[model samples]
Target: MADLTTTLCGIRMANPLVLASGVLGTTRAILTRAARAGAGAVTMKSISLEPRDGHPNPTILTFEAGVINAVGYSNPGVEEALAEFADLGDVPSPVIASVVGRNAEEFARVAERMARLPVAAIELPLSCPHTPGYGTLAGQSTPEATREITRAVRAVTAKPIFVKVSPNAQALGEIAAAAEQAGASAITAVNSMGPGMVINIEARRPVLAFKMGGVTGAALRPVALRCVYDIYRTVRIPVIGTGGVATGRHAIEMLMAGATAVGVGSAVAGGGVEVFARIAAEMAEWMDRNGVARVEELIGAAHR
Candidate 1:
């Protein structure tokens, strides 16, 4: 079998497949289950300073195009999350604590708290489309805002910082480059795209509770690939390419597009946690069949 191990910013992964934030990542049991299921790592759902119930019912919709959701970044707050993290003792895979904040100082506070956990690194969800006054607002508004958040978080933690940026950004490359300049250790390119809407023709209403949600799954693969390609060229840090990865081929494509790791979210919604091992198996099989010796050989291969 082809070797699947890869390293990002000094942390080593058994494979490149990471169970992306969201999608069954809310609790410690589920997160640990994913790691036990063969995920090289798992990112917890975004946590904030206070608990949030998020939007009402019908926050998610699934159709032929893909899954669209406005889950509103619901979470039990950082203190509760810290408790959850503390309960998960000796999980086999690395855990990346995903943090969301309304401002730079809040981001720093959360980062400091998460740094006390057993996590391997911290990930900042800078581009969540459904949540207002956070995520994309703090991320895509300006490169300066992105830089400030990154700097503050970096200052508080010795753990590697991974800033997840949005594909909806006006200056995607500039924002990514700014995060790099501000001391980010890695970049997770392209969160869900758009407050794209779907309507209930009979009810004459929006399908989602929020009226709009971020599009995910296969439909987002192309856009995410392009975002990773652009950010990869703009920044030297490792990139976690994520958006619509559903299969092994898609993971390979992301790596070829310059991802040091691949984040699988929507696919898990379909295949459950086993998607992590499945994707890894598929990637290794493909590499062996293609005469490739290891997964790292494919990283940025398409850039040429």
Candidate 2:
């Protein structure tokens, strides 16, 4: 059988399929469920220093190409998250804690707290496009901001930091390189793109209460692949390609594009948590048929 096992910053994974942040990662039970459902690793939803109500009702909308969500970083706060994920020993797969903040100080503070947990790593999502005080809207997408935030967090914890960058940034490669220089262990390339909107048409207004949200699913794969390819060339650190991955072929494409691992989020809405196992199995089958011996062999194949 083709070997699917891989490592990201020294953390071993049974496969490369990771459950992306913000999709069914709100609770420990769901995280564990995803792990048991076949996810090689699971990331919790973005947690903040304080609780947020998030956007009102119409936070999520589904279109033909993908999903658009402006959940507004709603979470019970880091305190609650600490309580929720305090014990991860029961989870079969490694847990990655995703943290968000309005600035480098907040990001560092939150990282300091979450680092105390037994998580496999800490993911800094500096790319969310929908929220006002966080992510791209807050100016966290720039190379300078990426460096400052990554450096601040690095000073507080020894845990591996995975900086998640925005797909919308034109200087995507530079931003990733900045993170690598600031002590980031890996780069999670391309968060959802566009705070794009969908109109209700009949109602004559936008569907989401926030009016705009990040785009994900099939529509984002190409852009994500390109971002990963660019970042892979710009930085020596591993890149976790995240955007619109849905199937085995997409996973393979991401690997060839230089992703050390693949992240799945919007697809879970359609395929359920079991999508992880399905994609991994499909990847194994494709590798077997193509005579690819191991998953690692495919990483950066396009660059070669």
Candidate 3:
């Protein structure tokens, strides 16, 4: 077997495959199941300071291309999350808590609460396109504000922090650098793009209840790869590459683009959690064919 183990911001992973911040990240059982299935690490769904109902139904729409969603950061507030966090130590794989907030104080408060848990790290989704006041408004609105939020979180936690940014933001490189300067240990690039919509031709109206939602799937790969590659050059910390990874080949591309770990999301809606094992196996096969002895050796190979 190939040595598939990798590290992100000092947290060791059995393999580079991470169950992205959404998907089956809600409860302890589902998260542990994903780990047993093959995920090296699991990121809990983005949580907030208070419980949110999220947007109405039809928040997600499926099409031939991929998935468009405006789930609106639905999560059971930090206080309620304590129950789930209690089971963290028993999980087979390391758990990373993903958090979102309306302002710097809220972001800090959430991180402070999560810091009490045994989480490997805290990820800030600073750039979610569909969410109005939380991610998009705080991140893309200004790099300085994003920096401040990160700084606030940094002030409260000794655990590693990862900042996940959106592609819709301007000066992505600068925004990433700002987070790093504010004490982020790593960066996850390119959250879904566009609050795009599909119209019901007969109904002559939008399909999704939210009207527009972030686009995720095969269409986002190239754009996300570029974002990771650019951020890799801008910051010294590791980058967690996520966008439309559906195969081991996609994972390899992210590593070459300087991602320390690759995130698996939308693919789950198709291949199920087994997609993690499939991708890992595919990656090993590719390595064998290329005579690559270690997975880490492939990181940033494209740049060299």
Q: Please tell me which predicted candidate would have the highest TM-score against the true structure.
A: 2
Which residues of candidate 3, in runs, are more than 4 Å off? 138-141
| Candidate 3 residue 37 C-alpha distance from true site, Å | 0.5
lDDT of 1 by residue, 175-205 (tens): 9999999999999987899879999899999
Q: Identify the candidate with maximal lDDT.
A: 2
Q: How many backbone clashes does candidate 2 have?
A: 0
- Give the distance in Å from residue 135's predicted Cα in candidate 3 to where it truly belongs: 0.9
TM-score of each: 0.97, 0.99, 0.98
Local distance difference test, each candidate? 0.88, 0.93, 0.88
**Per-candidate total of colliding backbone pairs:** 0, 0, 0
Candidate closer to the true structure by TM-score (higher is better), 2 or 3: 2
**Model 3 residue 140 distance off true place after TM-score fit, in angstroms:** 5.1
Estimate the TM-score for candidate 2.
0.99
With candidate 2 superimposed using the best TM-score fit, by how many Å does residue 293's alpha carbon deviate from the native? 1.3
